[model samples]
Target: MSDLYDNLKRTVEDLAAPADEQEAMLRKARVGPDELALDFDAFAAAALNLVESGELSSEAYEAVRALDAHLVAFSGANNAAEWTEDALYHSSNWATARELASKVLSLMG
Candidate 1:
């Protein structure tokens, strides 16, 4: 578990680190009102693709499921700021997502 955890953490840090091309693309994507805004669907698709490609393990799927439940709860809240705070700092969903991501990274390594 520790080996998996460490590997997963390294993989996520590498992937999450903004590369120049990705950064530029994100900047461009955010530039115009007409530009297609980044959406959760796109992110989910990418993650799913990783799973399909064998880059991520089945553990990631479980984590994502848990995270989605948390996101649903967060979305139902009235206070947007509070929801954001909870999602980022206090939600079990976020923890699950992190755990999944780490597991995936470990598998990749």
Candidate 2:
């Protein structure tokens, strides 16, 4: 296990959480604004580190990659409204991200 794995685990846990729980996590991590960016960035870095280190299985790495792509797309859309705490519960992208993150966790395990 590495710090990259720990960071990835923490981020993925938050991402895999239920909407309300995830929002609580975001709020707790918030320093100013766009708090989700922090964790999302951590996830990206962790995946990259693991890939470079050859520490993760291909299947697990692909799962992480898929979730990363999904989230990156959602965030890239510039749809600020959907990122809000209230909007998260109703956002299909968030739902899919959560599902994908959970799948990644399962694959990693």
**Which candidate has the highest lDDT of all?**
2
Ten-residue segment with the worst summed lDDT in candidate 1?
32-41
Model 2 worst lDDT run, 10 consecutive residues: 31-40
What digit string (tens of lDDT, one per residue) describes model 2 on residues 35-84? 55467566665686686787777788888888878877766456777667
Runs of candidate 1 with Cα error greater than 4 angstroms are 1-41, 84-109
TM-scores of all candidate predictions against the true structure: 0.39, 0.83
Candidate 2, residue 70: CA error in Å?
0.6
lDDT of 2 at 98: 84
What local lDDT score does residue 63 receive in model 1, on the 0 to 100 scale? 56
Q: Which candidate gets the maximum TM-score versus the true structure?
A: 2
Question: Residue-wise lDDT of candidate 1 within 1-109, one digit each (tens)?
Answer: 3433344344344323333433354456554211111233234434555567665666765554444444445453363552332333454544544554444444445
